[model samples]
Target: MAIALTTLVAEAQRYLNADSISDYCPNGLQVEGRPNVQRLVTGVTASQALIDAAIEAEADVILVHHGYFWKGEDPCVTGMKQRRLKALLANDISVLAYHLPLDVHPDVGNNVQLAAQLGITVEGPLNPDNPRTVGLVGSLDEPQSARDFARRVHQVLGREPLLVEGQQMIRRIGWCTGGGQGYIDEAVAAGVDLYLTGEASEQTFHSAQENGISFIAAGHHATERYGVQALGEYLAKRFAIEHIFIDCANPI
Candidate 1:
């Protein structure tokens, strides 16, 4: 069976509470396509490769965590942007994307999903005072060495994360998926024994070392792969439509 494009977008926006959340890009439908959608394609980003893959898969809609028209990006659609939009427009494939809404959601958020993958029992947000905080503080069932916890992270993410070991064992943990290294200080203030995020800057190493809190920088793509998939599964099951998650791998 097929679902109307409007219905799918509306349901997704409602499910993720996209309207209330302010974000860099528009949350709900970025591009409109055919009136009805039978097959949905989901991915981490709406790159040209993912768009091509969706086209090959004959998808009626493409859902992603990253979509077009960012806050500071150039408004002109000239080269790469033109090509991507052309392909989607030519094939009648709608593009729906959510950013911060997908990261902070209590159920299918990237942070929550990553915690489930790593066997961490969630305690609360990294910053209690900030209701919009994307990072979360949690605890392992038992204490483990920083190295051992890094091993678990590597195993679950299928990539060797950059680890900055601290003085203590990893009991309390903090994490935010996809380019959340900026929140390291917030995690530190939360008093987590370890902090994990998608990417790290040079100063992040010093923060981990001087503050004596373990830090891990898993790949941005690796850490964020789950939420869109979970959201896709939820939508597919809800609307009784076919859904396929396409992972256009990024080494970084």
Candidate 2:
């Protein structure tokens, strides 16, 4: 069944409460394409490879977690930007990006989805003071060794997570999906058994070791892959549109 692009974007924005949160990129309709959309493609990032695959799949719209036009990026449309924009304009495929909103949404959210996949029970936010806290603290069904928890992350995420072992056993854990290593401080302050995130900074190891909190740096792409896919499935079910998820893996 075909769905109007406006209706789809509106429903997504409403579900995510996209307008309430400040985001790096525009939440809905980053680039306008055809008015009616039947085939929708979703991905973690709207990179050129994903765009090409969507074009191959004959998608009318491309929805993703990471979209274009960040706070401090080159404003000019040239080089890679030129090629990407040109492809989208020529093909008439819309781009809808939801950054913080997708991460924070209680349902089809990266943190919650990751929790479900990793078998973590939701407890509360990592930073209770912050109203817009995207990071979360939770408990495992049963306590496992630091090594075993890392193994679990690897098994669930399909990639070997970089483990910074600190404590012997892990129960209380804090996590945010992509590039959220900065939140480790909050987790450390909260005295969680371990902290997990997509990317690790240079000082993340030091923080883990010194604070006696184990840490895991799962791949950013791997950690964030679930939200958009879940959103796609929800939209497909809600609107009766054909949804395709294209994975263009990034090692970093």
lDDT of 2 by residue, 41-110 (tens): 9999989999999999999999999999999899999999999999999999999999999998888999
The CA lDDT at 170 in model 2 is 94
Model 1 Cα lDDT, one tens digit per residue, 80-190: 999999999999999999999999989999999999999999999999998867899999999999999999989988999999999898999999998999999999999
What value does the lDDT take at residue 229 in candidate 2?
Answer: 96
lDDT of 2 at 204: 93
**Model 1 pairs whose backbones collide:** none
* TM-score per model over all chains: 0.99, 0.98
* Top model number, lDDT: 1
For model 1, give the 10-residue run with minimal summed lDDT. 130-139
